[model samples]
Target: MQGKAGFWNLSNKLTLFRIGVIPVVALLLLSPGRAPNLVAAALFLVAAITDTLDGYLARRRGTVTPLGKLLDPMADKLLLVTALIFLIPLGRVPTWAVAVIVARELAITTLRGIAASRGVIIAASWLGKVKNLLQLAAANLLILHHPYFSIDPHRLGTYVLYLALFFTVWSGLDYLWRYSRL
Candidate 1:
């Protein structure tokens, strides 16, 4: 049985699974037709669910490892960034909003790297987590990109993306401000 200190704990496996799903999700998103879009959205939703589950499992099971710490956020960025970029070509998401979100993600990731190098750990704040959740919601809805059950996924996704942008900027600025003070 894998112990809490083991590298291949269930949580880390889920994180790896999320990363592995990225390419397939990207392919589905790029494929033409509503069927492909729906599949991509479903896959993305699964990935998003794993995102939450991995963290919770890691914390609850005490199997949190350095690999999990590093890859969890990377998986999120890769999935979200890939989806948003593809959505741009599909005319589902605004290029500027994607740009802003991507910029913030890259900046914060860079900031975290710098902090790590200096023996500092910049943990994910609540605002940052909320930003990620909003981004995931937007990406899923935008990938679906169609009306269903009286809800316009595209329109709702746009609104959620806007909320995501606000949190992205806020959390990023918060990180920078804290880092600057250190």
Candidate 2:
């Protein structure tokens, strides 16, 4: 049991490492005159994959820890926020979208912190998960420059970003309403 727990812990740490890589990857992709966008996109994709794998492994292996619970969401938010921030000034994404998403994240983080103080674990909701998936899809599309399988990258990216923005606002409000009733 001890050994198994240690392995899961290690996996959790790796997830955090992947999360930390997002900002660097974003900067690399955003740099002017650099065609390294594809490389950066690959890194982002790897990080996103690891995010899914780590959580699934933790649950299947029964290695979920309080630390993992805390760090996992933090990592997700960091990656999303960093990617959106980088994409905004490039005109690939709108400032309003980033602002709304970031605001929602901040509100949820604050609510979670307050709830945790009272020993309440505000579990991730289905809406929240959907919001996350949409956000991830948006980030990936934007980073990939929307050219996957002959898709018009720029237009597709804009559409996805807008969709993600809508979900972000919806989920944020959902959380607020849920919290009020609790």
Candidate 3:
């Protein structure tokens, strides 16, 4: 039991670490000049890896906490939004795409806050999960500038972004409708 508790504690600490790294990764990505883009991309990749590992460890170890629940999504949103915002002006991503994604994130976050305040916990929908995956892929591709082993990174990123946007809109409306009915 002591060992289990220790493991769980470590898992929670890792989750916190993942949340804390987002800003540093964002700042690295935001730095001027192309030389650091690769470094920024690597940092972003590390941050993304931490995101996955933390969640997996939490579930596997049964270490989920209210703080984890809140911080996980919040960190994800911050990282993705910061990446989109920084990349837009760099000409690496489209402004409209970032706008749509940001709007969706904001709407869903607001709805989640409302639901939490009412003592209702909303599980992430399948569509929402897919949207997240696509968004992550898009961010990664955009950050790397889409180097191709015969595939166009920009076009693929654009396609994934659109898919993410579609799901984001759908999921947002679904949450809103569900909340209204409740």
Number of the top TM-score candidate: 1
Compare candidates 1 and 2 on TM-score and give the better one. 1
Put down candidate 2 lDDT per residue, 95-119, tens digits, no spaces. Answer: 8888898899999889888888888
Q: Give all TM-scores, in the order shown.
A: 0.92, 0.87, 0.83
Per-residue error for 35 in candidate 1, Å, reads: 1.6
Candidate 1 lDDT over residue span 1-182, tens digit each = 33456998889999999999889988998788889889989989999999999998998888888778879988988989998998898888889998999888888888888888899999889999899899999999999997889999999999999999999999999999989855
* Model 3 TM-score relative to the real fold: 0.83
How many clashes would you count in candidate 3?
0
Q: In order, what lDDT does every prediction score? A: 0.89, 0.78, 0.75
List residue ranges in candidate 3 displaced over 4 A.
Answer: 1-8, 31-35, 146-148
Worst 10 residues of 2 by lDDT: 1-10
lDDT-wise, the better of 2 and 3 is: 2
lDDT of 1 at 131: 91
